[model samples]
Target: MEFKDYYEVLGVSRTATADEIKKAYRRLAHKYHPDVSKERDAEERFKAVSEAYEVLHDAEKRRAYDQFGHDYRAGDEFRPPPGWQWQPHTGAHARSHRGPNPAEGFSQTDFSEFFSSLFGEGGFAGFGERAQQHARGRHSHARHGEDVTRPLEITLEEAFAGGNRALSVDNGSERRTLNVRIPAGIAPGQKIRLAGQGTPGSNGATAGDLYLEVAYRPHPLYQVDGRDLTLELPLAPWEAALGAKVEVPTLGGRVTLAVPAGAQSGQKLRLRGRGLPGKPAGDQFVRLKIVNPPADTPAARELFQKMADTLPFDPRAGLG
Candidate 1:
């Protein structure tokens, strides 16, 4: 059979790190997954990517593959060295003496002839037995489905208020709609899991889970840091010089904030428990930005000239 260059298939270098390989695999898997991809050759590409990851992600498999893979190019006729055979040890590759079972969901039939030649027919036969040991009295042919993770983008408001969101997912030949709950105070990079929502299992096996990683869409008025929020509040010169109560917008709603007398630009005022909700809720910080009224009209210019003459304050005195 022809040799497969797994690194080339995944578009990564031979010296790529395990994390790099995993990232590459996830990106390709998401792009080419048969349930969601629009490309005509998506199924084929997805299978190839999965097979590549299966070998590359395993340290033992990778070491063995690299030992003899240097000489052959992809698609070239290839064969294992004479007297070469696979022996299982500890870890995921451990095998039972039950021999090759074609009924297993993960087998040589699921991958290419090239893969089988490299890793043997029964290499993955023990995967289901080991991974699903908790499963009781399962059919001999049953196999759990693959888990999937995808990014879910939500608005800041939705994250703060906690609500139900409708998400549509495509299964083999149909569309499935799922209503997901958004918890209040859910932070970015947190994951929400849905059980039995991933790829369907075979022969009555339980399906895998689906994970939605949360991320926030850009908000126009606020910047988030963990659960805390920062809002730039603009104020007139008089409002800063003389204390004033101003209406400020927060995640919860508008609230009156008292600006201390002699408030300077960039001064921060904290509003306790005004950010995201939790046991100890985050606080919102309003940063003061003093704005000078424009002297576009004659009256405004006269007022500015009057202040310059009456106020004996020289701003440049400190600079010298």
Candidate 2:
């Protein structure tokens, strides 16, 4: 696919900041989620917006994309042109991707790594200390510890079944592994608190609890609603019209289903106690849709012709 304009996808201007981009994505994603959208093209529109946001949300990719325009590509196949990181035409020229490129004038001291990484740590540690030396003070009494925030993505299946999740996070200095238990019926924006898992505090105070906000990735076979699992099942024309016993798949497994005689396409069937596991298991709904059989054989065409002649009802008669 040709590259989509991230700004247009989010319905914002090119000058929009990171925070503005995030706000736009949140609003659009929630509106166009496949489970809730009623527009015919909602799902396709959702995926497009998501792809655009994914690129625009990354600082590196966004920079490269803004420089290269539609030439940018994502995924593991990302390959930047030679000298792509440096350009005299860009404001970023003041500093190399490797901090300010310095000569021997540095007094034998060198600083590498990104500025954001440094500031996240002790890069600013001397700010309060140096001022304190002039004021006859040693340190500032503050919540003087790094606050840890990491995003945790969960699949819809895992989110449905409340369980323990283990995640690894690097909080500037240390790599901490956290195992958190999730509660059932948790919403997408719900946060899972972790007691005393943050950075070390001053004056021997305790650490802060790590907060995990849950979000879901798209599922290949299922869609999630609040405490429910929705799926689209393809049924043969015979199955939809002539009432047959078919196997319906659920999170638990497949079970035999009875298709009521004269069932129409797009009919929804509810399977009780087969949805996402909650206090009381929610119902699983299957939307049956009919598909035309491939006309690979003469016999198949002949059989279909016979049925077409026999059925006198017009399924779309009422639609003006």
TM-score of each: 0.57, 0.52
lDDT of 1 by residue, 126-161 (tens): 233333442354567788789788899999899889
RMSD of each: 18.6, 19.9
**Cα distance off (Å), candidate 1, residue 163:** 0.3
* lDDT by residue for model 2 (1-320), tens: 23445666787544467898888887887777777889889866776666556556655445445543322322223333343322122244223321112122322112212212212221121222322442453344445345455567787657666677667877658887766655545667766545446676564433454566778778888877776787888888777777899888876678998989888778998998887665577788888888888978999899978878997977689996
Using TM-score, give the best candidate's number: 1
Going through the candidates in the order shown, the clash numbers are: 0, 0
- Location of the lowest summed lDDT over 10 successive residues in candidate 2: 117-126
C-alpha lDDT score of every prediction, in listed order? 0.77, 0.59
